[model samples]
Target: MLTLQRRQLVGHDILLARHGNHISTMRVDRQAGRVVAYLDDGSVDSAPNLITPGLPMPATVRSVLREDWKFFAVATACTTGFAGVMVAAAVALAGLSGEPGMTQLLSAYSGT
Candidate 1:
């Protein structure tokens, strides 16, 4: 639960190190009188030694958007199209049933 600023050191005062491609929040813990980096992925490293202080953290938001925005956009478009189709189908079914509201929907579901 440490609020780490960009390029901050993973010192004794800091309890976490947010770094890497996945932006993994590594927990800084003292074990056997040594500083350790506990990753959420269940890996551990010697924090003080392995991590270099004041190293610039990568901008994950920009990286993700740049690398994966096309996929995200495609997914969003597909979802929206599917929703539109569903709504249109429902409206058409309701109109065909000659009834309004839930009654039409119920009849359609009942196949009656």
Candidate 2:
């Protein structure tokens, strides 16, 4: 970013020539809702411009997934271990057999 002379600054709608006569793009001012750029005489311009690069799904989601993947794996592992332990305990301690069903237990606990 080139900083032109402050004397050359103008109003909020100060024009900036990116290439030729036409104003290609305008940069917004940070402090106010004005613009920042160069005018015909050359100066710093500013405005309240918002540029959206669009949603980067993979880039953004990757960070969130990376941060949560460990917890997800741990949760899944714990759930699997809990289910295994429950089945084992039922079979061994309770001497339960015949499909070792959990429908009744699951249904009763689900309500509670």
Candidate 3:
């Protein structure tokens, strides 16, 4: 079994466990169900959570969007729809006011 310790100041929960004689400090993410141990060899490895019982490991998401993709897609569609509506309203308002002739532009281009 792994002994759990919380370092609130560092915002990381450290997990300590003994393999044979040497005790290792590791980080246990209960949400992702992942245990990252800093080995004495200076190599980091994702250790198995089997050492920590009563902890159910869930699927880990690599990115934020990968977790809730459906919600993200809906939010994007809603924002795009709102922007399209605003643009449509502006175009309608402009059309209703009628077109303004560009007299200065026409004169400048025609060299009049």
lDDT of 3 by residue, 39-59 (tens): 676766564455455744344
Check candidate 1 and list the clashing pairs: none
Error of 1 at 36 (Å): 34
Ranking by lDDT: 1, 3, 2
Q: Give the TM-score of candidate 2.
A: 0.31
Best by lDDT: 1
Q: Which regions of candidate 2 are displaced past 4 Å?
A: 1-62, 94-112
Per-residue lDDT of candidate 2, residues 4-39 (tens digit): 232222333334433345444556564663565654
Ranking by TM-score: 1, 3, 2
TM-score of each: 0.40, 0.31, 0.39
**Model 3 weakest lDDT span, ten residues long:** 6-15
lDDT for residue 64 in candidate 2, whole number 0-100: 58
Error of 3 at 99 (Å): 7.7
Worst 10 residues of 1 by lDDT: 14-23
**Which regions of candidate 3 are displaced past 4 Å?**
1-15, 19-47, 50-65, 99-112
> For residues 33-110, could you state the per-residue lDDT of candidate 1 as single tens digits?
335555557775554622544654555555557878999999999999998998787776766775566545544554
